[model samples]
Target chain A: MQRPQELRNLFRLPLPRSFQLGSFPLRSHLRWILIRIVIKTFCGLTNTSIQSLERNKVASRFEVFALRLPPRIQPFDLYEAILKTNFRFKQNDIVIVSSKFVSISEGAVVQIDKIRVSHKAKVTAKKFQMDEKLTELVLREADQVYGGIPGFLLCKKNGMLCPNAGIDKSNIPRGYAVLYPHLPFESADKLRLNFINNNRLKLFVVISDSRLMPGRLGTTGIAIAVSGFKPVIDHRGEQDLFGNILRVTMRAVADGLASVGVALMGEGRESTPVVVVRGFEVNEEDRKMNWQDLAIDPLEDIYIRSFKSK
Target chain B: MQRPQELRNLFRLPLPRSFQLGSFPLRSHLRWILIRIVIKTFCGLTNTSIQSLERNKVASRFEVFALRLPPRIQPFDLYEAILKTNFRFKQNDIVIVSSKFVSISEGAVVQIDKIRVSHKAKVTAKKFQMDEKLTELVLREADQVYGGIPGFLLCKKNGMLCPNAGIDKSNIPRGYAVLYPHLPFESADKLRLNFINNNRLKLFVVISDSRLMPGRLGTTGIAIAVSGFKPVIDHRGEQDLFGNILRVTMRAVADGLASVGVALMGEGRESTPVVVVRGFEVNEEDRKMNWQDLAIDPLEDIYIRSFKSK
Candidate 1:
């Protein structure tokens, strides 16, 4: 029953100021916008070897870059950087990084050989009349795989959706597999703390990845994990200059910004993995971002939120 | 895996060679950096109705009358006069509008009794655990009523996330309700075509609404529908200045621009519905907008793209 005017009294907290990104020049500043204005990026990778030494070496190599940013800037690790570099970031600073790197660093990547092929993966593969190469492996590693949709396979381990069975091939040298970050939100929290303690500034962090949208021709970044951020920006109760209060106004700021930021960074070759954003006209104060922020409760989500399957 | 490269690509689409906006205080035409910016203000007539309408003729009462012009020696509404009065609009030229008027003209506003509940609504009411008084009526008009995760009841019809069980109580008559434009995209297309054909210019139309996000504070404008514009600018697989090929990069040009454009117009008592955006350097080729462009498919989505609830 409430419209824009009624929204005035509903705030559990203050609204984050809006950003004036258009004020910046489009040429050189575009990347700056992606990095500085960008938020997070996620990725999944397969490995040449799952050896602990290699893993540590890769983490260490990433660490090398992490230590290189201005101490004012968050460290390179998405989690640690956000937590440690909070001060350098502002209320609307963008924390852009890849999820593949995060997953690899957190040891989410698992050995594909160790997974046990399940009877279901075997049977379901037959039922869908599809290949068992990947499904067989999924059956072994998955706690439960649902037979609902395509492009994504549900695993029993966690309520996560990833491509190639959440197994990556990017950073992984040749044959090894990887999983998601072991403690995603924890990682984000750690990074959140890092930024908070390092500097007196309030900041947020996002662990993101480059992903495909089922029916679209392009891929954008999505936050796998986040802290000190609001995933969606609502505008349900507000007015325009025309004396008209708007209805049904909400923006998926995280995803929307992630997509733009990631696009500025390029998909595979560009490794400018860190984006530090500042100067937003709107945003949260001390709020922490979580899965709920990026995801619609289905209550607020309209299209994909509900469905009728045959 | 990718991000946006240089905006030199803004020229990729057929676009004007040059443009500018706003007027400089001293400079006759270069001062504001804000030309054709429509400032809109809203009032609820349900509280005052005919009385308010008596004072509410928009074109006459709400138009910018007393504002001072920097130095442009001209009779005002130059932009509006040309766009609205002359009914001339071009391609690639960006038009910012209020969704409300579009809704009103489209007959989106309706009487509450006109609604009908559904069986799913009953199940949803119980699932959402809502008060019985509201539940009975909610079920009728609700296209689908879903179970709540814990403490919320969700009712959806047409995939729009609305409250008051989707009943609105503002501006319109108290006994009536306003539904979302039956086919917003269609409405946008029709208007877009009129402007394009008449003005013979590359034009982009953005239908805006001011509303709240379920979990956040404050509200901003959102593009409910767009026509003749590239809503999203993707940069996946592009190279950054750092020579790294960005993995997942895409920019929500429309949404970002919308957020910023709405902010530039300033909120409240400023009643200006149409914002004429100029100086933005982009292209305008295909002048038709499809709702699908604004949505992401699950297959390519990172979250549930390949996942089912466990």
Candidate 2:
């Protein structure tokens, strides 16, 4: 072809909703483009008044909830949050759970003053090529310091790749750090199951963190863990009219969904820690999906093998 | 914290225009949006018409072109087509070799009567679980019948994933089938290097094939391979302000770009085999891109990879 035809718009598919995209260095309209996002916020004094909404109750489609749990809320609060949010809170057309909140709820956080790193952690740290000072910090009882190339420091306690080694500086003073939510999968399961039993909505719960992609402008969340959404689209034993059988390709629709969700969730603002998105079309058969369905193995990660986040 | 704060206007840098998605499933606007794209198509074509458009001649923004080559096309006709299509003709804008014509120019077509089969291919055919009758017919000098799962039957040769292994009944009509264009990557490279050296415009050349995605509707063109575009984004040593250092993660920007380009290219129908997308940016370090970049190592694949995309 000397000059090729511009082949855009060859088919029909609806474009996403428009929103202010702040994450990319490039202009992105991927955020706020979906009309079904549900958000919860704590603004006025009414924040204290917002109680955990109960289960199976009807709530607004577009809700902004404020939750006040006991200090160091328990996993039960995770359920309560959903109940209240979805009851009078109503299920989000789409729901988002903050990684920090999930970690804290599951007691994923560690009080630096209270922690005592283990001997094993220290040795593992060294073997992984971690810094001595950081290793010393971990030896004092870190869950796991991220293990990777020399320059990059993933979380020491959790496998998470966030700043502070999966430490949380949020919901706490600057001096203290938080850890990833413990038993995130369990936490995810409970909420997902409860949503199914109660609200009758297909909920996609993701254990998301502010992941750092090197060279990219901002933290677009990776679905570190997820459930409910059908994660993969499998096309095996099928042929084109032309008859070529497709081999080994499944769309990572969940990650793209999570990426879009995180994009919509915005990078740590909107005080809507958890967002509920609605109006997406999916069937009952797709509910309560597995985390593995959505997870891209670290090895298969094209970007992962090639680059490391420091 | 119950709800994270909603972050507004997070970009310190301006968003690039590439991410400005007007809509998803862009099928509706195909008829009209095409007009805006035609302008781009003309620009790319006019620049490369008749002969290689020289580098730096009209190389500021990314432009699109439609080139109908020589042999099948007359130089005079191309020159006239260029002027009528657009006023510019530079070598810088070409993104890939046109495959349809490549097959024609290479003359890889073969008569059905004269053929030979590889024992390896025959064994492989049985491995595909083809029917005995067809298998017997195919065994007549055919290397193998390449398709089977359910209802698909394909020719034993030709590298295409078509009903007849991309073997054609139309192009030949009487009794011949076209093989895949030979040394296709070589043709792609010549066009690529020519753009790089002659027009000097930053470009990538992809020799594409229409492929089917499992579980999704319709086919999209995929790059057999590519050069010039930064195929992958390696995010090593990167940290979000959250401070999580990433050990592995790279964005397959080129492949995704190709997928989107296919969406824009619209398979064989547009005959706009080469798509010149502007404003799509990537880290420039790895300019010599690879097809390997797109292949998720089998181990990392999660499906089939009972564990991952293994």
Candidate 3:
């Protein structure tokens, strides 16, 4: 559970520093009282609580823009590419980078010819009708290989559920595949730190990847790694509008922002591997998001647990 | 399969109609050839294919803004409230409305005192440690119930997986719960048509609701109903950057845009019920999204299959 003060930070309002009615001059106090009356009348007319007025004031400030980057054939300085775009970074702005972009920058490419298919890989490949070399890579990269479809291996990688252990054969040359970035959290942190130290701007970084949700037809964005802010905002202790204590209502801020980024960075070859989101506020900190904090035990997951009970 | 011509619409370029090289005047021919050379040179320098150049040109045009509307304490005219906001609806603008807003307008609130609990509701409620009346509502609304946790019932409602049959208890007065809107697809389609017939503008409408993904701690937005556009964009026949045909890469454009809308409309007391997305290029039509088109068989779902395989 988050501290009460921290939870209140989500709807922190802008008000006067002091409310000492006696200390204020008569003229100023009369003006303040008039302002409150106006606010109350407005809320009554709109059927809005004062809380919503403050929250919506904050909500309206968010701005998101996708940055077009030069396509990467090999590893290069990511910071330089961003700087070249002439997009000025502001304090607390979030930078969402496609995981594929991070992988390419880290030179995490694996040529198919170099991979030696093992006997296990060959058998699994045959069962799923997949390429033996690619299956070998999936086997090596995945923490646990659950099962597979014809072209995709259902696997768990770095505490996240994904297909083919987050390997990609698209947007790269033939006969080569790009793995998820090496030490993604470290990469995100390093990038965040680079901006802070070199540019003197505190910025958040998120490495995003696209995933197909169960029973859904298309892919949505998920956060692979995050730096400078908590990925999930815990709302367990908060009260709903009905005044019921919310027991399980955390906001997956990172994943939601990732989806926004991915929408702008089209799945096809758009070359927009980066997106900048401004004015959506979250507590900035020198922290890297841990997989353990974001993921739950598979057995306890509702979707998985339902199947187990069946 | 979608027609190949329709698939090509995703990345339709802004090239001139005439491609007959021999029929062009020499000056015009030289200009055309020069343009191609410049494009080729730019592509060569940036490692971007000409396809991406055209695609990014389209990607850069999206703009999203949330509209603050008066809170509805009772059933009211939705279209009237939208017109009250004084937002000029443009062609192809997508209007995302929170499902709660629609539910309220439909008088979908269930007063806890007015509900009668059944024997089965009592037994099921005791098992899940939930309110019997709410349990009865869930049982009544759900198409299929698949077990549950202490406070929530895992159920499929309207071909969509949700907790508690998508019944919401927050943001309303005490002792009352709001059910999912009646005929959500019809509501969305009617809203879309209302804008067209009255305002003389083509508009897309999506009724969005928030849901927690399996193993994820917080909620992301999902589209319950969509009008005026295909909710999913199929990319099956499109070529990847490597020139390999994409087999299964559908883009959940509606859901993605819904998530974007939810981010701006804060879950708590923020009274932003509608969000307008402008300049997002999707073919608009007089069609409502069907569940059969969005959902797949439960047996084929990867997450469930993995658990069953285990």
Most accurate candidate by DockQ = 3
Q: Which CAPRI tier for candidate 2?
A: incorrect
**Ranking of candidates on lDDT, top first:** 3, 1, 2
**What tens-digit string does per-residue lDDT give for candidate 2 at A1-310?**
2211111121122433323334333232222111111111112111111211211111111112222223343334677654543222334344557676777666655445554556764665566565444444544434443344443344333333333355444444433455556656667777787877876855666666544333222343444556655544554555422344444434444343344344333332223356443333332334454434544333333223222211
Q: Candidate 3 residues A1-310, lDDT tens each?
A: 1122422354364435453334555454444443444443333322122333434421354556688887786998777777777665689889999999999988999898899999999999998889999999999999888777767788888887878999988888888899988788998888988898899998999889987777777888888888998887777777765566666777888888888887778766677899888767775656446876566754577777666654
How much DockQ does model 3 earn?
A: 0.20
Docking class of 3: incorrect
- Model 1 off-target regions past 4 Å? A1-92, A104-120, A126-144, A155-178, A192-201, A209-222, A230-277, A281-310, B1-101, B105-107, B113-174, B190-203, B206-224, B230-310
All candidates: TM-score? 0.49, 0.39, 0.79
Per-residue lDDT over B202-308 for candidate 1, one digit per residue giving the tens place of the 0 to 100 score: 56667755433322333444566777767666665665433444444555455544543344333334334455454343445365555556555323443333333
Candidate 3, residues B166-195: lDDT per residue as tens digits?
Answer: 997887887888998888998998888888
lDDT of 3 at B79: 87
Regions of model 3 farther than 4 Å from truth: A1-59, B1-61
Cα displacement (angstroms), candidate 3, residue A214, comes to: 1.9
Across B264-289, the per-residue lDDT of candidate 2 in tens digits comes to: 33322223434444333444433443
| Candidate 3 local lDDT, residue B186 | 88
